[model samples]
Target: MPSSVCIMEDPPVDRLTSPILKKYYPCPNASPGYFSLRHKFRSLFQLPRIHASELPVQQNKPVSPADALTAAAESLQKKVVQNKSLISEVEIQQFLSSETGSDRLKRMYTKDVDGFQSPELWFIGQSLLKICGMTFLITSYIGGKHGGEKFAKENQATAFRTQFQASRLRNDHVVLAGMKSGFIWTYRVGIFSSIFLFLSQSIAVYRNKSSVMEYVIASGVTGSLLKANLGPKGMMSGGVFGSLMGLVGGTLIYGFMLMTNETQEQRHYWNIQKYLEVQRELNKGGD
Candidate 1:
């Protein structure tokens, strides 16, 4: 009877509240908090925070055509007004000094043009010379001789307005040609100098030959290049090539006209003649 009473009082038989049986225990290794956050996020009506670094970098907005044109027009007007103001001042002075109407107008235009030319000319001249020098050097180095002179002659700055043109500069061909010229000219000068020394027996010819050629080529080419407003490399190609060509042509003419004295039989005779001539000259000086 006591056993039956214990069985009737057993803890209300609720499955959720019942003590866990060791045989049917749940897995402890499974994720516990993973689903909780996801569930809570789904239930909430808020957005997730994103880092600032996750956003793309922004670039500056480009200037519109209207804006650019407006800016240029405004800048030009400013310059024009400045010039006109100066002309007005000059005109007032001229009129006050008893100048005629046409004379005053002439003076104003002249003053403005002159004013613009003076400063701008100085700026353009410096830039032209620099570009020309570079063109000359580079061209001569690459194109041998022709490259240097062509630039030296053609691209010269005849007017200040030419600077604005992009076409008036060294091209790739001139530069490549200039490099070729440098190698060839150096070799030509060396061989020619040796020949000059042998013929004239002049130490000065052999020693200063390279400098002489460079100077000769550099002068006409460099100065003409200044006028041409050409690139340095192109100028170099022209000058070196031109001068060397002249030298080669001159050599060919001289070669055909000269008599050949090179013979085994005459070799000793020529040597003795030279030796005796030297001895006689020495003896005359009391050697």
Candidate 2:
């Protein structure tokens, strides 16, 4: 009998439809070129392809109940294999860098961030946030207490305006006297612009739709303006930039008063007169 003819062909793919087969899904010893290809081959039989965002994405392989226990055991074995110092620098650093997967993840994140903030400060902030709904306490005090929640809060904005004026006058006196005490003293050079930006933010919060957004925008403006006022070195290193910042600050703050509506007391006094006239007419009608 004649030997049977052997036919071999390259496996057909969606992109390449060829009867001639050069290789299977992956050639033996083929470089793990793309991560996608490596992962694809690893779970090619286990995972299902799903259409997502117009891309063919592989969904997670379904794990059997037995597989879950097996995985958990493997995880425990991995934990055992990891080397851990009895006591570590991690403890001194206020965090644990252990064999624990969660700790490792946290350590990685902290490393990437380059030690963002102090734990002590974080605790203090948490305590204050819980004690008072003061998300922007630092901001409130910096503006000479002329703006923020006190002034433009709860439709009692008139109260805020009066308080703000009083605060500005106090700061003006401080600046004129060269009285450097507290934040006012420390940031005295830019105090003028400080007041102005405060008033602007306050007005925006009270009159505009979103107070938070106004302040967020204000913060960016304030930082730039503050830098201009202080310059590279700062107040004692007072340059032309510092002088300009102070001038701008003063103009903005007092100008806001000139631009806005009348004080609450003045408006109330006018309304009272109208009320008295109405009362007199009602009494006359009864008579």
Candidate 3:
């Protein structure tokens, strides 16, 4: 009789099908060589292997259109509320505080000043002062000229003719007549010019826009009106001259503002540099 042999064999473990390995490495048919290389890498890095059960499951629930819109609206409302909160009582108080007289005067020349009864009044006052002063100086100079003196004397004679004593007028009277003529001219030009300019600028400000065109239009209109007593040729010439002057003045002002802004930026940069230097010195001393 032949002897019978008994054999026992253990089943191979399917590591790729395990919950932990399957969660991390999804490929079930991966080669044993690849697994060995991964194991070597993990060992070299000394990385801890995390189990699938240790991770929390994250479910991506579908969002509805209405829900998305509601969320967006809520976010927008929150942002508006946050922005509103940024402007505080202290800021309002500071903005409303009284300004110095000199500061108010300065702003009158460039921008509308606060604490005034009316912005229009402020603009009117500024225009009056500037235009009147310029006109006074110009008319006085012109009146001192030879032709201007003769013209004034003629006017004085005409006036005194009603008294029947034209030749008997004093030197002081002639001088007074000349001054009177200058005053009349100054008033005519200055008052009308100021009114036109103020109206033009106010319109621009109201429209939330200001440009060289505003000045040009104002000056042209004022010049045309002033020369209306003369022929159309005079009116045209006056308008052209005024427009040219306005253009030159506006360009100069814009250039000046640009230079001022550049200077201010440079000053701010220097101030920051100085502050940084001081901070560094203090830190070094502390160390």
Q: Which lDDT tens digits does candidate 3 get at residues 1-287?
A: 11222111111245644576544555545655666666666568675889999999999999999999999999988986764324344543443344343443343345322234334355567878888877877776565554445755567535554444543444455566557767988888776767566756554443333456766777777777778789899899888887787788756754674667633234323433443445555665678
Ranking by TM-score: 3, 1, 2
Q: List the candidates ranked by lDDT, beginning with the highest.
A: 3, 1, 2
Which regions in candidate 3 have their CA more than 4 angstroms from the true location? 1-115, 141-170, 230-234, 257-287
Cα lDDT of candidate 2 equals 0.42
Q: Write the per-residue lDDT of candidate 1 for residues 110-187, one digit (tens) a residue.
A: 323124422223333455555445555654855645664676577575444554452444455466676676555555
Which 10-residue window of candidate 2 scores lowest in summed lDDT?
1-10
Better of 2 and 3 by TM-score: 3
lDDT of 2 by residue, 1-287 (tens): 22232222222233232322222333333232443464456565676766678786789998999999999999977875562222233332332122343433232233222345323234334554443333233433545344333333434424445767866755565343332233343343244334434544344323422223333344445545556666655533343444455456545644564557433223323433433444545665667
Q: Candidate 3 at residue 183, lDDT?
A: 93
Clashes of each: 44, 7, 0
Model 3: per-residue Cα lDDT at residue 157: 35
In angstroms, how far off is 103's CA in candidate 2?
A: 57
- Candidate lDDT (C-alpha), each: 0.44, 0.42, 0.58
